[model samples]
Target: MTIRLGLQIPNFSYGTGIAELFPTVIAQAREAEAAGFDSVFVMDHFYQLPMLGSPDQPMLEAYTALGALATATERVQLGTLVTGNTYRNPTLLAKSITTLDVISRGRAVLGIGTGWFELEHDQLGFEFGTFTDRFEKLDEALQIILPMLKGERPTFAGKHYRVREAMANPRFRDHIPLMIGGSGEKKTIPLAVRHFDHLNVIAGFDELAAKIDVVKARCDDLGRDPATLETSMLVTAMVDERATPDLIPSGMRQRMVVGSAESIAEQLQEKVFDAGVDGVIMNLPTSVQGYQPGQITALGAALKPLTAG
Candidate 1:
């Protein structure tokens, strides 16, 4: 369930047409599998992130993409980097993930979070609730989803979601790994300690040490071992000749890695792994060399040894 090393395909606009888009994605996932990555993730979004590109840019639905990737790669665990809880019903969400587990032969990891993008909700006709409201929904949704994943039909009533004897069938595994992506101490970390097996910390690199400490403290508060709750952070990797440190976006400077594969690995070792986080999920959205045939392999070769344990 640990994500020591993972690849996240967060971009779809490759300047190559739609026909070539998925093939590039498949190639990257296969490369990741061949080069020792333990997991592969795709961003769960309907529109391109503002930082990456315009909203109109191509963004494949996460589950559909992962289901296809499951057949393409034999070993890599497949899941979304983080799924928005606002988009679907809890009962259906459980079914979708378990089905993916069956497709991937028990390789599905459910990475979910309180859906935040207001635009997606507004335009897609989903409810755009307040911050507190979203968290409440997430809490209730988990109540139904957890039991269903474990093969126990759960009957529950809550403010946001309720299901009576909800069941998921044709499951390949009794327990699929649960993950939530966020770094908030009060709500997210507590939920991670209570239910999630992994917490993908969404924080700046300079803040990682503190975030890990909070995760540990929350686990201790719940009388759970911090080691049991694995943690990872997404790093936008730009492995190319043009990977200048100054070229990084102001908001993303702390979270992105620039330069050669060796340098990128060294920076991660110093900036992220040394902070006590458990894993690194590298996202090569638009790195110049990243779309090339062998770049993912190069990065994996240079970085895998550090996280092999």
Candidate 2:
């Protein structure tokens, strides 16, 4: 089993402008590739964290940033950590991803999810409905987007979305892996079992092993092969030795492969075999320490050697 290493491109209002973030992101992608990392994933947020001060602070859109990443890195795959389906029309979203896949020469993964951040929807004037409603919309989005990607002229009439003809431009284009994020037992996991090529969850080795069991059971009930769904985790980490252990949630810390290289490598191995995850999207809380891109690049380099071991 080959475990792939990936990093999350953090976006928050740390008071640094896009000038600070863009070049750093480019450099990090380049360095991750050089260091033998497999992928780089970014977030999709419209507003910065209010806890970070100010409501309308700096936040980069996911797809546009991914377009830039297409030119920045040669080997490392680039896409969202997970894009919210509520943010865009299904047809338009499919077109953007298809264009991105073309530009990246078949390296884009459509990491999508049912939108969770209520603040984003409220601030952006989009409907902040019940969780059920949002999941319904997400289901519809997946149905429309998948067929559109596969050269079908799709027409979906859901409670949330309506499409007469979903035709992707630069039509019948390349295939990009569809990765769904979240661990909602009812909707998200079932959707993953049905549609996603990969499923991402935020949990430790033991907890993840249990969740994978649940997913496998669901797959069995659906008469689908559990192996068809590749498993992954989105982990939060702090590399600084001085940092307190309680920075992130305890569950996340267990998933986080921090500390020295050897220790981190051991944790990663456990995450792979024990957790049953094939990949990890390391979420470096750089904003917490005002870390430069090179700092992240260094972290990527430090972990890169362990991928081969």
Candidate 3:
């Protein structure tokens, strides 16, 4: 259930020809595993995100890529940073992750969140609902997913979903850890305290401490130990010494860490870890263009110890 240091491959625009695209991804995943990363994640999106590039830019289906990743690497965990709950049926989503757990020999992590990204929904024919509608769907969907992940057959009917004795068979383990990604103190944090094993705090570096404190307060209100809920921050990372702060988009500047790998590690330890977040999941968006031979390995080496006890 731990995410000591995770690498997220958020883009697929490697300059290489199509033939070398996946090989390049495999190289990064292997580098992360070899450098002692605990997990690897991909964004669960149907199109390239606005922050990264145009809608038509290269993007891979999250589960398909994660399934392929399961076979390519042996040690590090595989998952989406957070699967959009509105993309698929709850029962089916449960089956998909359970199948991945079986394939990866129990390395699956069920990271999920309320669906966002309006364009994907509008273009893909999925319903584009209000934010509250999406969160309601997520809440009811988890009622089905959580029990099935634990090998139970759940039968329930809710406002947004209905399941009749839904089951996921051939599970690799009795439980597949559940992770929720968000920073909303009212909805997201309380939901995490109720159901999730991990919380991937999606907030700016300056706001991370406040979010962590909210998580702690939510746990306290529920009469639960704050330490029981693992916490991590999703940070935009720059590992190359040549990378300057100007390369970061102005809107994303507050969320990014730039410098040499060692200095980036120092910033994360001081800001994220010291703020009470248990770990970090970093996305090096620039690497989609190209990465040096040992760049990811070097970054992983510098950051893994920060998450270790």
Candidate 4:
């Protein structure tokens, strides 16, 4: 089968009511399903980035929003792009995924990362530690969280977290796929090779290839089959009627897929063949005028023939 496709709904609406965003998210999920997209993901940020708007701008938490999404859509799989490991305790986070998995009928994949946003953690009163310290914590968190699904009461003590017989009750039906998100070669790729079911990198073909090579080598050294680990990318895309000179924004194309249907398809092919990516999660243009429903529909149409088995 061909690599699956996903979309990142960045939660970019102009409103305050929590219920208001549901319609947009539901619509996007439906669009993804209709377009034959395999999954739909949302950012786990507590606040909007400054470039997008205000730092204090409205945003939603990860689990609560995902719970609502679980009830809203039917076919499309859903989860966070990269949930911050420091946000919640590992057992609690695993339970949250368990609950969401049941609610969504086993359609949840856990995307996790070491996390980089200090401002959010500070503003929200979560401890912000050193880089190496965070990676250490992440490694420990994975060990604690992964076993909880197997009905194991985990006991782990590290420099950051010390857990004693943490119980995960009423486990979900399946082992929710764990996806590691980041491009760090030494630390992130090794962790992914050892623990995660998938790896998500935000880079072009060249960088993605290099990271994949690193992970593959690590997997080989660990006596693991590299094919067992899936690869995915997060891409910003602007889909208009046709390609134009100014269609793509500067300093963004390296991380984005822009232009006509043919151009976009070529990029997708490169990701699959060159970078060995198994899937892509496109971040569709949210703020651009006349791009929402129409462009989304067009993108779905363009990708239909390619995604069709």
Candidate 5:
């Protein structure tokens, strides 16, 4: 259930031919596992995000890819960084993740969030609702999902969904760790405090401390222990001596780390961990260009110790 150090594969545009794409992905996953990463993630999106590239860029379906990855590696927990609730029916999402858990032999993490990508909904024929509407949907979806994961058949009726004694069979474990990704104090943090096992804080490096404080306050108000709710941050990483600060897009510079492996580790310890986050999940978008054999291994070797309990 712990994600001490994780790698997120956000892009699949390797310059190689189509057959080499998945082999490259497997190599990266194996490298992460060997180098001490406890978990691996992929972005849950139907189309490529604008920040990363054009809409038509290659993007694999999250759970299907995770199922395939389960057979290719022996360790390293697998899941999406966060699943969008609007993309699928709650009962179906529950079934899919449980199936993944069975395939992976109990190494599944349910990372979920209220849907945010408008283009996906518009193009894919999903409802593109207002912020409050999405949150309501997410809150109701969890009501159905949590009970099913615990092997209970729940009958629920809400504004967005209704389920009559829905059950998720063939589950490898009774409890799959739940992770919520976002830093919205009013909605997301409060939801995490009440329901999730982990909170993946999405914020700039400068805003991390404040976000952690808000999480603590929310826990306090609920008469809950803040320490029980684990936390992590997502950062864009560049692990090369030749990488320079100017190469980063201006809008993303504050949320990105650029340097050699050792320097990146130092920055994480000082900036991310020092702000009270439990660990980090790094996304190396540059790897799609062509990753050197040992880049992930070197970064993992330097970073894992800092995240150890």
Candidate 6:
């Protein structure tokens, strides 16, 4: 349930050929583990987002990649940063994560959110409903998924989904940690308070404090301790020693930080940790240029003190 330090591998489109793609990913995950990160995450997308690259850019299926990562790295938890709920059936998603937990000896974390990519939906043929529709679907999906993860066969018949005594077998643990990602106060935070072990905050830097306040307030309203629901911010880190503000893209400037190892740590401590978040889950979009052998190792070293217990 705790992810004080997480490394997200959101870019797979390195300059290398497809043959070298996954080996590079394995190297990053393994390096993160060696450098002291508690978790490694991949984006759950079928195509690259517009901001990152062209839609045709290389992208791996999230859970399939995570399952392979389970065998490559030991001691680091693995999962998607957030799986899009519309992409898979609830029962099937449960089975996927449970199998992951067993394979990793209980290092699986179920990170999900209401699917939002219109392009992916339109092209991939998954139903892209209204905002309210997607949230409602997620609510119902959780009703079915939580029970199956707990080793109970739940027969849920909601408007969006139906399951008859659906089960997930050979579980590594009765519970796999659940994390919901998004910034919506109305739906995302409330549902997170109701069910998830963590909330991976997706917000602009200026909005982070208010989001934390809302999370605490929501927990208070539900009579649950805010500390019981851990939180982390998703940040894109440019880890080069020569990193400068101009290097960050205008659209992503607020969500990203550009600096060396020490300076990056300082910014995170001031902007993120000092903003009162529990932890950080960061990705290096620049890494897509190609793998720098020691990039994650250096960043993870600087971040360890901030994430230390």
- Model 4's alpha-carbon lDDT is 0.76
Model 1's alpha-carbon lDDT is: 0.90
- Off-target runs (Cα >4 Å) in candidate 2 are 1-3, 12-17, 49-54, 204-206, 241-257, 292-309
Question: Candidate 5: how large is its RMSD?
Answer: 1.1
Candidate 4 per-residue lDDT, tens place, 100-132, comes to 888888888888987778888899998879888
Q: How does each model score on lDDT? A: 0.90, 0.74, 0.89, 0.76, 0.91, 0.91
Any residue pairs clashing in model 4, and if so which? none
Give a tens-digit lDDT track for model 5, residues 240-278. Answer: 888888888899877898889999999999999999999
Each candidate structure's TM-score, on Cα atoms with residue i matched to residue i, is: 0.97, 0.88, 0.97, 0.91, 0.98, 0.98
Candidate 6 clashing pairs, residues 3+ apart or interchain? none
Q: Per-residue alpha-carbon lDDT of model 2 for 209-260, expressed as tens digits?
A: 7788889999999999988788778766666555455565654556655664
What are the per-residue Cα lDDT tens digits for candidate 1 across 1-309?
A: 878999999888877878888998899899999989999999889998878778898899999999999999999999998999999999989999999999999999999998988888898999978989999998989999988999999999889887889999989988999999998888988999999899999999989999999888888888999989999999988887667899887888989989999999999999999999889999885523337777789889999878987
**Model 2 weakest 10-residue run by lDDT:** 49-58
Tens-digit lDDT track for model 6 on 153-181? 99988899999999999899998999999
- Candidate 4 ranges beyond 4 A from true positions: 1-3, 14-19, 242-246, 271-273, 304-309
On a 0 to 100 scale, what is the lDDT of residue 85 in model 1? 91
TM-score of 4: 0.91
Q: Which model is ahead, 1 or 4, in terms of TM-score?
A: 1
Runs of candidate 5 exceeding 4 Å displacement: none
Off by over 4 Å in 1: 287-290
CA RMSD, predictions in order:
1.3, 2.8, 1.2, 2.4, 1.1, 1.0
What TM-score would candidate 6 get against the native? Answer: 0.98
Better of 3 and 6 by lDDT: 6
